[model samples]
Target: MDIDLTAARVVLLGRPGCHLCDLARDVVQQVVAETGDSFAEAVVDEDPVLLERYAEQIPVTFVDGRQHDYWRVDPVRLRRALAR
Candidate 1:
């Protein structure tokens, strides 16, 4: 698939209608904006691989390809992660 690698400096996986996911995204966005980081938002249900791996863990955060947090995105920790 054609993709924008730079768009995913921070990856957030979630599904629509998930409150925790919504909350996490908001938290992530705040941290990203503060740190001037690029980000990718993925609806887990849209990708079989991600859906299978993260179906039960809707709001997952990844920093530079490594899992960072889940369920709830921590703004302080996210800021720290992005600063790295």
Candidate 2:
């Protein structure tokens, strides 16, 4: 509840009733526990533009405002991105 609000900027693009999206959210929560970094969630379905752009890729992840991961999260790749 009192974690650092700076360290990394992450945005998760997901939709309701998507299991993969749920998984991605869990992954981000776990990473936050380990990294003490701030994390935010964005439901792509809320925005027409984002929904249109990522309709196929439900669990899209963006780090520092740039696309970093998608569909499935590669733990090694995620760690590397955070280390940057």
Candidate 3:
């Protein structure tokens, strides 16, 4: 699948079989459901640049193409960011 990162307001960088990524995905889905924003997932291991930059931060969250959070997704903070 082709993910248009530029069009997505939220981008999730993760790899397969990642526990943290799974948790983050749940949080992201909940937040976006409430906020009516769209999100996309990119496999860090699939892209060299993403893998290099986020290998240690598999569950990274990006809002508007800028880094938002890593390891975990804070619902309150995410709601605040989306309101911006």
lDDT of 3 by residue, 32-69 (tens): 99999999998887777777777998799999988999
Q: Candidate 2 — which residues are off by over 4 angstroms?
A: 1-8
In order of appearance, the predictions have TM-scores of: 0.87, 0.84, 0.92
The candidate with the higher lDDT, 1 or 2, is 1
Cα lDDT tens digits for candidate 1, 1-84: 122223588988887899998899888888878888888987777777777777887788888888888888878888888887
* Clash count of each predicted structure: 0, 0, 0
Superior candidate under TM-score, 1 versus 2: 1
Which of the numbered candidates is closest to the native, going by highest lDDT? Answer: 3
- List, residue by residue over 1-84, the lDDT tens digit for candidate 2: 122213248777787889998998888877766767667877776777777877898798887777888897766677678778
Best by TM-score: 3
**CA lDDT of 49 in candidate 2?**
75
